[model samples]
Target: MSTTVLHARTLPGDAEQRWPARLWGVLAVLCLVVFLDGLDGSMISIALPSVGHDLGMGTASLQWIVNGYYLGYGGLLLLGGRAADMLGRRRVFLIALGVFAAASLLSSVAASGSLLIATRFVKGVAAAFTAPASLSLLTTTFPEGAQRNGALSVFSLFGALGYSLGLVLGGVLDGFGWRYVFLMPVPLALLALVVGWKLISRDRRPRPGRRDHADRGRRRVR
Candidate 1:
């Protein structure tokens, strides 16, 4: 007599699945980063008049404060993605996030309009790196299919919410001081950095077998 045996094959993303709590943590951390990006972008609009008044900046000079940030963000966005691919995603994200926080702190205490605009540009450059890295981390962390779709929906929601809240918060915080708008994100970013360090998975190094295979393929092509 002969016996037949059957083994089930796992789906593509099955092996990458994490516990629900950990998945939420990853999503939250990424969401927070996106939130900060949106917040910083919109928050200053409400505070701009106050900033101009305080710094005695003209309209033309005040415009640069906003324009400088967008210039840095739009210019380097593609480079940020390439960086994440070459370096580890988490490493790039965390480092950029730190830079964003530091820039935010400096912006709050800037002695001149030029210094403030410079810091805002730095913040935007940092954000360019962080925005892509956060998305890369999110896609890699969550497997494709329903899980990834749901996580993405939530991730996008935080961005819109952050912008909305920033508008309101900008008005409220500006009442206290224009500086508060810049200062608010510093603590939140630091918190995300600390928590992300623990929750986000480390990047996988290339296997020796795969490296050798790739090398052999390249040699054949050449």
Candidate 2:
């Protein structure tokens, strides 16, 4: 009789690993970055009066300043998502954050209304890439079922909090200078980039064989 040792295979969902504490830290960093994006988006709106005064922008130009950023952001979202999927999410997220920080810096240093508006358009494009990629990364990192639900809930809560905080912070920063609102995200984005690079490892799972093939077939049918 031959004796054989058999090891049990754990299913993806059946793995008994608990949520690591580092995951929370990563999540918090992601939240802060997302919050900054939200804050920056609204900060200009609240500070428009001050901005117009400083830059001598008229009403029509002011409207263009705001509208241009939105148009750029919304128009590029689909492209951003596809890019995130094609490139690595982590790589794209960091690149977007870098672009966003650069744009914020430019906005802060802008001497004219047109310069500021142009910077805002760049920032919006950067955000289009960063936001969805960050969320998709979080979803992919966290295990599914209860843990994933909890993580998503926390992410959503931070998003809501960021929006409310932005409104309050915008008012306060407006009193100081309109530039500070734009400058604020620079440090936060930097911090997030650092933490994300240090703590998050690339996903190393081998692509599922049959499922992947089936998915490709479905896509072809579509």
Candidate 3:
């Protein structure tokens, strides 16, 4: 007697079918958010001379202005990722974006160099939350397939573009005023917030019944 071998076949889930449109929109918003993040990261560097001259910042204070933001951003990244997993990525992303925008506005209006630096620190904290949430949202939303690969590629390209564009935009805005350099992200961030809220699905915890059903289905398939 000849035995036939059966190859295991994996089926696409409901999320794979329903989430593509929403996922695309979310991807666009995330790209923009990351772009703004990259822009802000470099913009300050280009505008530092003007900022120091205008605010009459000494050398030590100038170093702190940049160092503070870096320290804050690095310190909060892991915590932010955990928060996104616990609180839900979309919720955290929106909240972070809002915080970032508010901080940017504060930096724009700050009266002293110290105040502006403080706002930059706050912005860095907000970015820590935004960056991880944005990426996590994309990963969770898309399933493993050509689609997911394409989405990630696009996301990476946007990040790189943002980094490069930051220098150019910084030069243009810095020519106007150092304040413009800080204020530039506000509108884009607002737009990203609006798009993200509209496009990203709320992260729901898996219900017990759903988990049980999945387990039962797997057993039956076996």
TM-score of each: 0.87, 0.82, 0.83
Model 3 residue 145 lDDT score: 84
Instruction: Return whichever of 1 and 2 wins on TM-score.
Output: 1
Clashing pairs in 2: none
Candidates in descending lDDT order: 1, 3, 2
Candidate 2 Cα misplacement greater than 4 A, ranges: 1-18, 203-222
Per-candidate total of colliding backbone pairs: 0, 0, 0
Question: Least accurate stretch of 10 residues (summed lDDT) in model 1?
Answer: 1-10
Q: On residues 102-211, what C-alpha lDDT tens digit does candidate 2 reach at each position?
A: 99899888999889889889988998898888888888888887888888888888878887888788899888898887788888888888888887767454567998
| Predicted structure with the largest TM-score when compared to the true one | 1
Instruction: Please write out the lDDT profile of model 3 over residues 117-150, one tens digit for every residue.
Output: 8999999999999989988988887778867787
Question: CA lDDT of each candidate?
Answer: 0.91, 0.82, 0.86
Tell me the TM-score of model 2.
Answer: 0.82
lDDT of 2 at 123: 88
